[model samples]
Structures are given as C-alpha cells and as structure tokens.
Target: MPQKFALKQYLPNSSRLVYGCMGLGGNWQRLPLTDGDIKQAHAVVETALEAGMTLFDHADIYTHGNAEETFSHLFKQNPALRSKMVLQTKCSIRFADEQHVGRYDQSKSYILKAVDASLKRLGTEYIDILLLHRPDALMEPEEVALAFEQLLKSGKVRHFGVSNMHSGQIKLLSRALEVPLIVNQLELSLLKHDWVDAGTTFNDDQSKTNRVLGDTIEHCRLENIQLQAWGSMANGLYTGAKIDSNRFNDKQNAALLATKELVTNLANLYGVGKEAIVLAWLLRHPAKIQPVIGTVNLDRIKACAQALTLELTREQWYQLYVTARGQALP
Candidate 1:
C-alpha cells in the first residue's frame, strides 16, 4: 500500500463514482437527436446527481460529440445545477473519416480548439478538469504544456490530466508543465487485472510480459495522481449479454463464468446488487480508484452507488481476485 490521494482536497466534494457520459448521447453515426434521447439523458443525469455523482466524465468524440450536447440540456433547464457538479472532459481522439486517418492529436492547436468545442457543447464556462483522451504518439510535451498554461490562464480549465497513459508519458508531460497532473484514467475492472498482476509477478517468469501497466498504479500513488477507471464493470460481463459475445477465448470464457458465479454468491451474501460487488472490488483497492460506469439506466446507476457503502474484507477481496484470475497467486 502507498499514500492515498484524496480527491475532495482538489474537487472540494467530489463523488467516489464518476458517471461516464458515453452512453447519454444515444448512438454513433446517427443524426438528428430525438426527444426521447434528451428525456433519457435528463433522467440519467438527475439519477446520478441524486446518487451523489458530482464528477461527470465526457470526451469530445463521445457519440460524435452529442453526449455533451445532450447534457447541456440539463443546464438549460436548471442553470443552478452547474454549481453542484464537477465536470471533466477529454480531447485529442480524432475519429477516422474519409478526410483524415484516425489518430491521436495532442498538438497545441488541436487541444486548444477541442477544449473550446467541448465547452460550447457542454454549455459551461469552465471545465473542472480536462484530460488528453489518449497518448498522442507525436505529442510535444512542451507544446502540450503551453496549451495547459493558456487554458489555465484563461480560466477555461482548472486542472489537467491524461487518459490511457503510462507513467513515462505522464512524467514527460509533467516535466514540461507548471501545474500538477491530478488524474490518470485507465481501463480497470474485475476482468482487467493486469495492473495488479504486474506488481504481484514483478520478478517472476510466470508474470505476463506484454500486459504490464508500467507500474502505473504505484506511480500514480507516489505522484498523488488519482486513478479514474473506465470500463470498470468489464463491459457488463456479469450483468449483460455474456453469452452473445465472441470476444473471449476458452480460458477467458472459463474465467468469466467462474468469476460470475463467485460474484453472484458474494453479492447475495452481502445483500447488494451484482454491480456493487464489481465496483466494490475496485473500491477496496488502496488506490481508492473512481470507477466510471457508462450505464445510463437509473436503476443500474443507483446500484453502482451502493459500492460506496459496502466494504470487502482482505480475505474476501483476495478470494474474488483469485476466482477472477482463475488461479492462485504465484
């Protein structure tokens, strides 16, 4: 275990669970937003706020930029809601259309322009935190620092961070910036255990070689960068359409089934939703990771909020981990 980074010190009353706004804007490549979609967004946003989810996660490319567009409707309805929430959005992931190849763009101009677009769509004067959506292969750290400095000076963005970035990349960018990087968003869940597995198997041959998270979890702790996990529910392996997908191999399928069985038993024992157990698994980690759940269903949102109240013991936590991993620790 390492020193903890408390988010409240930075956000001043942020929630443990972040509501990922990816699902709010309806479908991708579809045009002409419908009234039902707007209504659903309102309902989901209201539900998350009621559940104490102050941090809303968004990306400029989410639903082709309509997630933020749809969420702006809430502020349009009640402007006061703006003061109650901490808004965070990401930029730099450009989709591949006929005109340009799909790639990352951390260039100063792109970052600056993207933030302005996000602010306009979100209908907010300032974004509480702005994150680079993913690591740009050609990123100029100094250029990125310039963008951060300009945004900070203009009072458009308060803090800066990165998503899907390793410690080396974060370090490079941090060196060029005056402000501290506060968050590192990554894909972590009961199903995605590589981050923990790397540490446990650090010096062993049985350790996975290619799946290393580059000491990211520990690095984040040492640097006091809060980790925010996306895809934290494992793409609904336990709660949604498990049988229909061909994404898993035989071994992975077996692990998934065993993990589901164990989660179900524990879920019943604790008298909480299955989602809570999934989220609780991450919350129990010393990192105090904030899981960004992408479901727009009100009931499911409330179920995830239950994780804040439930705590798993050390033995129970390891039991779930071993069950999900399909093997005992080496």
Candidate 2:
C-alpha cells in the first residue's frame, strides 16, 4: 500500500478519512461557546488524531462560523497540533439575511474576505486547502483566479478546491486559474449513490431519476484530483442512526433495511464495527474517495477509523451497492 492518500498530491500527509468540522461547536447560534461545547470539541479532536485523521474539513458557514472558532481552541491548547494537521476549509455560501435571500458568492471580494474570516476563526496563518463551497451561477473564472492568486501570494491559502461542483464547472474554473484544483467534494454514499449511477444508469430508464447527475467521479479520477465524499455515511441511515421512517418509500425502506443487514454481517466477518464496514464500502472504490466522517461520538469515530485497514472484496462491494440502490443494475 502507498504511504499517503490520493490527496497526497496536494496534502502530502493527508488521511484517507477527513475529520469534518461541521459538527463542531455546540450550535449555530451566535451565543458564546459553553464549557460543554469546548469539552466536546477537545474530545473529538483528540479522537480524530488518534484515528489517524490529520486532515480536518471545515466551512466558513458551519455552525455560523462557530465550528472554526471552536476548533481554534484545540490549537490554543496545543500549538504544536497546528503543524501536525492539515486544515481544509471552504467559502462562497452566504445565508439569507433580512434584506437579501440566501445565495452563492464567488466574486473576488467575497472570496478574499471569506478566507480572511476563516483564517482568523481557525487561528491558523494558512489554510492547507480552500474550496469554494458551491458554484455561483454568476461566478467569473477570471475573478476567482485573481482571488486565488492573491490568496496564494499572501500566504493565507496553500492549495485550492471546490465542493458540489461538476466536472465542466471545475474544468471551466480551472482554465482561468494558475493552480490545479486539488480536490472536489461531493455528496456520495450508499444511501446517495448517484456518483456511481452516472456510469451505470446511462442510456437507460434509471437516468431520469438521477437528480444530482454528472460524470464527476470519472473526471476527477482522470485528472488525479482528490474526490472527497461528504455525507459519506448517509447520516448513519444504514449503520443504525435513528431516522424517521416516514421519509422513505416502501422500496427505499426495504433497501435501507437490507443494506443494514449486509453491513452488519460483513462487520462481524471483518471483526470490526459496523461503521468501519460502511466506510470500507466507500474506500473499496478505485477512486480512493476520501470519506469525511463528521460523527462527534467517540466510539463512532473509532469505529469509522477501522475502515482505514479494512478492504472489501469486489463481491462484497457490489452486494452493498445493489442493496443500497433499492434495485439491481439494469
């Protein structure tokens, strides 16, 4: 096995599993951080480090910026940790206020200001990777390129990336930038399987139902751009997170239950926890898709880390896929 992940192209010592900071801090409220929130943050950071998750994912809007603020406490406690970990964050998402409706902003000014705020909140001098959280329909590639160049030269950001963007969008944006977009994060998991469906469901009836459609995985693979899976665990639907069954239809419910059963069986066989089996399914893919796990629960974090060493066979990987899809391949 190689010593580093595909992300190593950009983040040399990055982990296969990124510790998502979306769940950090107590709440999205503007209130000050309570002692309980600080305690939980410390615990999750320590557990993530022990699990070999040295790369932390953050967004400026996570918890209304409280997540990054809370994470800064970790570095304050141990300044050395700043050097030990690679911190990746995002911007370009602005929530609606009284005067303006919520929207995406990729303008040069917005990108620059957002990074400055993220740096201050993270208490870090430089961001390992800065991703545009989402694409703005009105984004100008030249404008974004200018912002990225300034960020790089100013020593505020080391590398750049994008989230929730398709290949064409990334390609178009990259054309104007001096930097190679190093990462592309998307919603990919057993529960939300369209990342794989783009290849399988084409020229067939199943194509119509694919909402988040794109050949992004293939494009990223070909370009050697790291593909990070957000919502990789399906909010724990398959691994036993309590969810209201009301949201799923009959077929969806059946598939969820069936996938859960198969994951459990495999977990016992692999001698690891169910979380590991679930994540192992993602890691089994050739894309080397890094799973950004956001579970703040200590045991769950440890369970997910087990996937670092677990490798699912081809058959097992397909079994989990079909079961989660709620239908067999065409």
Candidate 3:
C-alpha cells in the first residue's frame, strides 16, 4: 500500500512536510534576489506540488521579505497553482541590519499592517496559517487577540501560532485570545536537544538559558498546539561541516559520524536519503511534529518530502539520540 500523509487538526489536511521558503529568494544577508533565482524557486514549488507536497512556509523577515515577493510573482504567473496548496507566513522581528535590530511587535497596529503587507506580497486574500515570527517582550496579548479576531472576521487569516516562544508565553497569549494558537515553530534536532535536558543541571546557568524543549513540547500536546520543527537540519551543522574542525571537535565529530552511519543505514532501508532520515528522527516523536524544510535545491526538497514515509522504530530513534548526545540515555 502507498504511504498516507499525516494531518494535524490545526492545518488543512495537506502534506506532512512543509517546504520553508526562507532561503528561496536569497540568503539572510540582504542579498539581491535575481530573476533566475526566482525562476528556480518557482520550479522547486512546482516540483513539490507534483510530488504531493502542498504546504509552503514563509515569513516577512525572510530574505528581508523578498521570499514572499518571489512567491507572489510565481503565484501570479501561475494562478491555478495557488488554490492547490496551503500558504503560511510569519510576521514581526524588525531588523535593519545584522547589528541594528528592532524589537518584536504584536500590537494591533503592527499585526494588522503586517498581514496586509503579507497579503499583498503573497498575492492571496487569506493565509492558511499566520505565525508570529518570534516572541515580543512587550506584546500585548489582548491587542494580539483583537487583531487575530479582526483578521479571522475579515477572512484575511484562517489560523494562528507562534515561533520560538516558551510555554509560559504561549499560555499567556492563549488566556487573552479566543482562537487557538495552533502551532509553535521551534529549533529541534538530534544535536540540538538542549531543550531536552535544559533544567537538569547540565553545566552552568548560561547553558540552561535556552533549554526548555521538554516544557514546550509537553505544553503543546496538552494544548493541542502543533509543533513545527525549524532548523531541522541543524543549519547544516551535521551535513556540511568538516569533521576535523574545532567546532566539530573529537567528541562532536564522533557523534556526527555515528549519526551519519545510522542515517545511511536507515536511508538505504527506506529507499530515501540521509536528509529524510534526519526528518524522520523528529517525526518519530509523539509531538506531532511537522518539519519546515528550507532548501532551495529541488533535489533536497524532494529528498525531504520523502521523509514523510520513513518511519523509525523506538529503539532506533533512541540510538540516534544517544549518538547525537555522545552519551547513554538518562
């Protein structure tokens, strides 16, 4: 029998894996998005659709908003393809350069204006999912709730969620909003499991600062908020780096090698690629994770989409985790 795609109640029953367009138009350093690049990105989306992958993820700050523009350009040229897919985008996180960064904005004015800008750029009236790009310390939950209410009423946005927020923040926002915050985009991978052992007295307080993965994962399940894994490939830390580099020191290199071996074995067994094994590792969790893959390469996109069918047994999943951590399971 053919494999079936898993669907979360929050998003329309689309593909199990979502294609992230952050790196499509250009890189993050405010590079110019060329016509050829745009065409290539369109081809990636077309290929994804042809493979039965329909969900596309984007954000206003991605490539300084040029990613959305590229998507809009492609959708305008191929209008029929728009209805066949589910479109999602993010807002907030203002930055002029790598140094001069602006604070997060979740006020009614910012949210309203941001959605309008996204709508114009996406060339669509309604976004399937709208997520706050990051947590704004000064965000007024009531104002955000009001803005979401208006968007829902105006048919501009259908669902809402957040990215890189703690459980407390998500809970606070839920208290003030009537709509369910359906998803939380987070950083999760075998090598980046700080959230898993965050509060277990690892080394020092500084290392524990960002270690809230367990809380965030558990809370999402309790709240029925889907967990979306961003940086699913660990920003190419596992695949592209040299094994002898200082960054991937002896211990880390050994872990990477072990992971590589496991990935290779699983890929051959599943008739997929190593990238698919990385994604399958995350999906094996009970968190109902949907990986947001950011690959401009069409082959990479197809490889990631194949992860939807690669299933890992419980013991194999734990073995990968142990290999990544360079230690036995606690």
Candidate 4:
C-alpha cells in the first residue's frame, strides 16, 4: 500500500527544497515592517517560485507571527499565486510574555485558536498542512486529536504533523488521532549530525553515543512519514569568510576549517555552489529528507534550489559526512 502522506501526495510538483519563511517578516522586536522588508520578501518569494520551489514552510510564532503577515503581501499582489503553491504552517508555540512563560500548548482550545489566528494572518481560508510546532509536555492526546478532527472536518487544515518529535511521542499521539501524522521537521544539517552520528557510531562509546534520534528515524520510515530538515544550510558554516574569523575557540575553529576545506573540495568536484553540495548530501539519503532552507537573499535562495538537480555519489556523500563529523567511522 502507498504511504499515507507522501511528499508528492500533497505536492506532486513540489520542490524537494522547501523554503523557510522565518526571514520574510522583519525582526521579532515588534517594529512595523518597512517597505524594504516587503520588497525583500517579494524578491525572495519570486526567486523561490521561479526556481520551482512551491512548498513553503512557516510557523505561527515566526517573527511574532509577522512572517505569515508579510507573506500575505505576496498573495495580495498576485492573488492567483495562492493556488500555485502548497502552504504549510505550524501552531502550538505560546511565546513568552508578562502573563506566562514560553511553552508548548496542544490543548484543544489553544490548538483551535492558533489555527484560526494563523489562517487570519495568512489571509487564507484553509491550510495545506498544519504542523504542531513542538511536542507539548502536558499535551492531552485525545484533546489534540479532537482539535485535529474538527479542523479537518471543517476544511481548515488538510494534513497534520509535528516538529522535534521522537517515535515514542508520535506513537502516543497517533493512538488518539484518526488522521495519520505525516511529517517530522527536525534540526538536521552537516554541522548538526546527531541524527546520523548515533546510527553510524552505534555500540561505540564516543561523544556521539546518545542514539536518541535513531528510533525516531526508523519509526518515521516504517510509518511512511516524511522527514523535513530545518537549518539545512547550517547557518552558512561553510559559506566563505564566515568560518575564517578568529573569534571562535581554537578546537572549534580548527574543526570548522577542516570541514570547510573538505566542503570546498567537494564543491569544486561537483561543479556547484557549496550550499547545493551541502543540501544535496541530505537529499542523497534514502529517507528522502526534504531540507527547509531559511535563506532570504535571492541569489542564495536560487543557489540552494540547485540541490534539486545535483546528485552526490555514495563515496562523495560519505566523504562529506566523515569530514563534517570531524572523525572517522568506527
């Protein structure tokens, strides 16, 4: 049988590269968005769209919810653009304020309210996919399931998923959910390879013996849930001049310089931008990891799309992995 929430099921022509809209909205300081902010967002959206990237990833708490508000300007300018893309936004993150500390809320009331607020901000009646921003410590599975059921029945959200979740939590939530959870967005990149290290160094007693995310990856694969990777570019760790500074500690900077050298060599061999090479490594996985890139610069955004077409060989992939990990396989 086919998987319940395959990428193509919702996004047939979706780019393997998902665009993160966190940079669209201005800073989170509550200042009014300037005309330049809108213009930058417009250029980013236009660049991504032209590069065939249609799946946009958003969170209600991004830039204090102004990110979605900023993106709405695009649709307002070209209303038809709304139908041309697959829009996915997240809820459940309650920002910190005077009244309450920052926390996660999966309660029925909060979930429902967050969805309505996100819809209003996006200026859309329905969301393509609605993801719970994070796992709530006090989450009542039945209450969350009820909210999802109502949202689906009311045509407010089409799909459901979670971020930063593991297998045990997903199973606990799935028991009460009539709809299958489809996506797990994780913080995965060359620099942050905990997800891969645990598997590669299994049974070894090095610094990377936690193996926490191993079961989560296996469960997602078995359940046919798509894995979306955030921070896919690693905050430009390998982007020129960024790693050449003297501020970092000796050990840390030394490791970075080594990895940057390896990345540079691979970039030359592959004849593509370093960002594409980095993203392509994630794409080369059998799990079909979809990387969400957060770059707003038009040139970098377009450069990242190149990962969709590039293919890294098995040896090259492992080489990049070993270099990034700064150690050899056991």
lDDT of each structure? 0.88, 0.90, 0.80, 0.85
lDDT of 3: 0.80
TM-score of 1: 0.96
Ranking by TM-score: 2, 1, 4, 3
The top-ranked prediction according to TM-score is: 2
Highest lDDT against the true fold, candidate: 2
Number of clashes recorded per candidate: 0, 0, 1, 0
| TM-score of model 2 (CA atoms) | 0.98
- Model 1 has an lDDT value of 0.88
Q: On residues 63-179, what C-alpha lDDT tens digit does candidate 1 reach at each position?
A: 898899986888999899899899999999998889999999999999999999999999999999999999999999999999999999999999988999999999999999999
RMSD vs true structure, all candidates = 2.1, 1.2, 3.1, 2.6
Which ten-residue region of model 3 has the weakest summed lDDT? 1-10
| Cα error of candidate 1 at position 299, Å | 0.9
Q: In model 3, how large is the Cα lDDT of residue 292?
A: 81
How does candidate 3 fare on TM-score? 0.90
**Shift in Å, residue 162, candidate 2:** 0.1
Question: Candidate 4 lDDT, tens digit per residue, 1-330?
Answer: 221235776567566789999987889898777777778878888899998788999999888888888767777888998888889999988888999999999999999999999998888888988998888999999999999999999999988999999999999999999999889999988888888887777888763555677688879988988899999998889766366466677766766778788878877877777888889888888888889999988888877877766788999889888877767888
